[model samples]
Target: MPTPSEFFDPSFIAILKLFLAMLLGGIIGTERAVFARQAAGTRTFGLVAMGACLFIVTGNYVDVAYLGVLSFDPLRVAAAIIMGIGFLGGGLIIFRGDSLHGVTTAAGLWIVAGIGMAVGFGLYLIAIFATFLTLLMFTGMWFVEDRFKHWFEEVKGDSR
Candidate 1:
């Protein structure tokens, strides 16, 4: 049997962080899938979050292990992750004349990456709160946006 301390080991904590990241990402992705009908849903968001968390955790481990031997900036890994996510987000966006699609989905992916990084850094409360806020934005803001659109259309029609 493993000792209680073993459960609190760094490796175990890292795994926990990854799991939390995935769970949070999946929650956002589920909202997108069910409501937004986006193609990149739970699996995509979960993988993005998990991959980001893995990069951060591994970077931290490398930094600590090479403390005196080599100079390593873990923040560089985070910057790289953000840049990569930006590239991915760009791919999600499509512009056609007067309309743009997938902007919100791209933004969601970006925020999801940040959430993963926060979880990797053990900012559990912040990550959870961010996830909640994200859900609110996705669902609540959608309703507000739709209402505004309808109201604007009605006013426009009356003016015409």
Candidate 2:
């Protein structure tokens, strides 16, 4: 067997970690693509996740330096990313004569960013697990909401 150093170099480990983050982030994004189509689809979600991951990685690297120098906040980048993403989301939103749409797309963008942050921290299991849970919620939530709405309406009809 190789030595510990050979098996684990800091550079290799960091790179591998970053790659895994991108992979998992992409997976989370695919879930969003289902509802974000025609607005912020698969490619947009993937980009958002990767961008957030990079911002979080930078935040980790410059946190101490910025803190020590009193030059800037390391979280500034992340804050800016979040704000800019909000603007993008707003653009995606629509209110056509009181008919609302695109909120799901906007929310997906936000969630993709969170997944990226998890990946940036090299929390592979959490990131992957979160992706599964998010997907499940995205699908099951709609069904649950619809079913409840139908059931409530049926009961109300009987009462009437």
Q: In lDDT terms, which candidate is top?
A: 1
lDDT of 2 by residue, 30-60 (tens): 6666553455666777777777777777676
Q: Tell how far residue 86 is off in model 2, in angstroms.
A: 1.6
Q: Which clashing pairs does model 2 show?
A: none
RMSD in angstroms between candidate 1 and the native structure over all alpha carbons: 3.0
State candidate 2's TM-score.
0.75
Ten residues in a row with the worst lDDT in model 1? Answer: 3-12
Model 1 residue pairs with clashes: none
lDDT by candidate, in order shown: 0.93, 0.72
lDDT of 1 by residue, 1-160 (tens): 9954376989988898999999999999999889899987999898899889999999999999999999998889999999999999999999899999999999999999999999988888999999999999999999999999999999999998
TM-scores of the models, in the order given: 0.93, 0.75
- lDDT value for candidate 1? 0.93
Q: In model 2, how large is the Cα lDDT of residue 87? A: 86
